[model samples]
Target: MNFKSILFALTTLVTLSLAIVLNPQITSPSADTKWRAGDTRTVTWDTENVTGGPIPEGMKGTIKLGYLDPKDGPNEHLNWDLGSGFDLNKGSFVVTLPSELETKRTYIIVLMGDSGNASPQFTITAAR
Candidate 1:
């Protein structure tokens, strides 16, 4: 193969490897998940995908509640901090949904850290 072709192949492999190592895959709150306002739910991810094995001590991450209204076009709004300063290595955390949240099917959970990873869109219904 030509030198340029070899170089391009190597670069592409490195980039894909880095992406796999750096991005943690969210596993919970799946596409079929339905959470109720005022309820506590567990958010989980694949710890194996985390770089350097587990997250280091004192390394923290935040979880945010995101909203995308179909009526409002494609703008996604991260409107609330569900929790923060969490250990990303544990692979999971429990969060209490705010009782005041409106019933919506477009709610998503975003895990914020070195690289933000989001869960599939889920439903959040009004509290009973």
Candidate 2:
């Protein structure tokens, strides 16, 4: 390949990498996170890397709780709406775990709107 072609390819790769790194991402409720049902917990994310600054004020989004079914994949049938109309720029929100939630390690938090982001697998245990 010509030198110009190789240079163009390298630049394109770098740009894409930077774009991915700058996207909003979930920062809390990570893979090791564990919570008890019926307890109030906070979910947070990183906006510093978001392009054009953090999500603008008044821009809202929704958060949902999903489960990873061993037989299937991510199951959103429960439609566990944790919260809605949340200010995305706030970077965090509070959620109360449903007391009826099954004790499992495959629970995940999904932030929807604009560019959706999903947290790593977390655990939710039965309420005491």
Candidate 2 TM-score, true structure as reference: 0.75
Per-residue alpha-carbon lDDT of candidate 1 for residues 93-128, written as tens digits (9 for 90 to 100): 999999999998899999876778888899999998
Model 1 score (lDDT): 0.84
- Model 1, stretches more than 4 Å misplaced? 1-21, 50-57
**Candidate of highest TM-score:** 1
RMSD versus native structure for model 1: 5.5
What is the Cα-based lDDT of residue 120 in candidate 1?
86
User: What's model 2's overall lDDT?
Assistant: 0.81
Q: Between which residue pairs do clashes occur in model 1?
A: none
C-alpha TM-score for every candidate: 0.76, 0.75
Per-residue alpha-carbon lDDT of candidate 2 for residues 9-40, written as tens digits (9 for 90 to 100): 99999997556422368888999998998999
